[model samples]
Target: MKETVKTKRRSFKHLVPPVDLTGRIERSTRMDRTIHAVAKAVRRRLGPGRLRDLLHGVPTGKPLHPPLVTVSLGCWVATAVLDLTHADPRAARAVLTTGIATALPAAAAGITDWSSLHREQQRVGFVHAVANLTAVGLYAGSLALRLAGDDRRGRLLSFAALGAAGLGGQLGGHLAYRQAAGANHAESVAHLVPLGWHDLCELKDLPDGRPVARRLGYIDLFVLRVGEGVTVLADGCSHLAGPLHQGRLVSEDGSACVVCPWHGSTFRLSDGTVAHGPATAPQPSFETRIRRDGVLQVRPAPL
Candidate 1:
């Protein structure tokens, strides 16, 4: 008798293993060369100064991209609703044009922020920007159709554009929530410290004029000793978690500052306030006191 070979049945999961699409995109190495070149170009294009700062929301202590994106997306979505309801063609066209206009500034702010992120974040952000630009192009086509009196076709095209925009928005959400892009990385220090002063080190132990990393609880701190005074702030850079102790000390706007090594985000040494763009949020600072026993102690400064 001939023995039959057994064939194991394969289900969908067996045929195709589950994928972490976002993870894969973030971990991809294939795009590194292009990402570096493009990021450099974007930085060069945007340049440095107030324009970049305004776009980054440095003046307001928040990223302008989010609000600008909200307005642009809101207008586009409103236009689609108007079309479905058979609202006045003028109303539909008006909102569509407004969306197209607002998206320009939004794009500027977004790419400005993207250039300062880590390589992994930049990877996802590049795809996110592409999807958004595609949606904008589709919306432009829809607007042209509407202006040409092809109202029905325009409505259909707008709906398609909305789908593209939705995809882009989903990618953006991934960047914000999962990757923590534009989030203040050093904002958690206040809650982590216990009541009263925590011991850092003895006064004589810290070297003068040099920034050093110290730990308190689970938090890493940037500690600087100059003469008898001690300066302490959260070690994580507000922009991207680059160790502040690893940063270079400089004078910005005639004030003492430390420039983040990873992205050049400047934070004032006096109060941990930001002195440069690409980092809108201030680093959490702490008050220092020397105990009678010569041990340096620190506590969270009053907000």
Candidate 2:
């Protein structure tokens, strides 16, 4: 250490300020609050469970919004291309009409998507929606102007709309891919779980057929012993991480399922498959074996 030593310097080159979107952010936040209020009111009228099921395609076991949004984007692109290059006014009008018609379904799908998202995700989604709506308005105005003989003004407005839509699309991408909002959070749990089950509790400690809460290091697991076999799953529900241990166990078609206390999401005890929706991701399952000493041990199941 007395000799000359070179220290490796840390670089902050990749660090940058938050995207300079203060004005947009503020407007989006306000809008998000308004949307939140409206959504709450609507949910109250619709009933929470009904609203959740309706909006999230939980019954279908998939996200309904992403595909619908993609279709909207495609229609928007088609409209823009036609407006920019088509010599026939009829063709341009047709394309514009199609785009306008497409937006309604897109909005419906977006609303459904928004209902299942967390508060933070809803905030981001609000901004993304507003940006796309602005772009749609611009495109509509451009079309009107072009039809009224203001070709130059129409082209400018169309281009502006395109830019706004692009920005909105990018933000939506961040919300989905980057934040992993509305994504399956349980898929990675297998990797985090230790290879074998550590001690959870004595067999006598858990009531038969009732959900029992047990801890493994920092993670919480729910255990249900059926017959001689023990079923272990993440205690947190995949939908909103609601405590699964508090939920009731039901026998559905001869298989055991645990229903979430918060949102009623259900997971199968046999394989951790999602038996009901609002939760797209399956719960993490652990393989259970009785040790030679008669202690219960668990290991993460292979994918």
Candidate 3:
């Protein structure tokens, strides 16, 4: 029998991410002053509320910016197809205008999400915003030129806009996947936690009316004891894994809530659901029971 050798195909997942530009940008503190000023302004302007939560896609349970961006990019690409095929100039202008118009809401959600990110994420996001804004400006000029009966120049400007938009989109992808910005940082807790009740601590040992951190297998849990009632939730903020144990516990809407110290994402203690975002995903909450031996035990709550 003859032995045959076969070559294995290269897997995309096995390939390393192109992070050179992002690493340099993340390390360079050249724009820290400007980044800080803009970040503060955005946070103040887009503070936690119904309107802000809606923009963060808390209601839809997804980031609105990502999906909204597709509409604008799709229209711009359609315009490019029309221009390249030497199709009617009026059709190209119509699609280009639509892309420009839809960019407003997409930008609104993008900036809102950017406001609650880590400093490093914000640095990359600033550059991403600049590239996108440049694209919008170029597209707007393209529209103006078309209206002025300069189809050739309009097409040229639109092509430039596509380049800028593509650059912005690439940076956005890096943020979403590599940096894990806007991702559910605490999503793995349920998977790692074992079924059945795990011993937490004796009820009397818990600090009264204070939030504290406790270990539950691989997950760190945020435990709060107010009189006889106990609330247990995964200790990581669902946004960026900000320490919920280090957060401020306050009453909002007549319910106890913990505000993430890092990005201010708020979760209601009752069921670990987002009362405010930047965190579209809910924290993993647990059900507790006190054993006959005075031990407090908890298990993952039913979905």
Best by lDDT: 3
Q: What is the TM-score of each candidate against the true structure?
A: 0.92, 0.72, 0.92
Per-residue CA lDDT of candidate 1, range 1-303, in tens? 999999997668765537877788899999889999999998998887889889899999999999999998999999988988999999999999999899999999999999999899999998889889988998999999988999989889889889889878988999999999999887777778876888989989999999999999989999999999999999989888999999999988889899898888889989988888799999999999999999999998887
Candidate 1 vs 3: which has more lDDT: 3
Worst 10 residues of 1 by lDDT: 9-18
Name the runs in model 2 displaced over 4 angstroms. Answer: 1-35, 45-55, 85-98, 140-157, 194-200, 226-229, 248-256, 261-264
lDDT of 2 by residue, 8-58 (tens): 999886785566463355345556668778667644554545445645666
lDDT of each: 0.90, 0.73, 0.91
Q: What pairs collide in candidate 1?
A: none
Question: How well does candidate 3 score on lDDT at residue 143?
Answer: 96
lDDT of 1: 0.90
TM-score of 2: 0.72
Candidate 2 lowest-lDDT run of ten? 20-29
Candidate 3 regions off by >4 Å? 1-19
Clashing pairs for model 3 are none
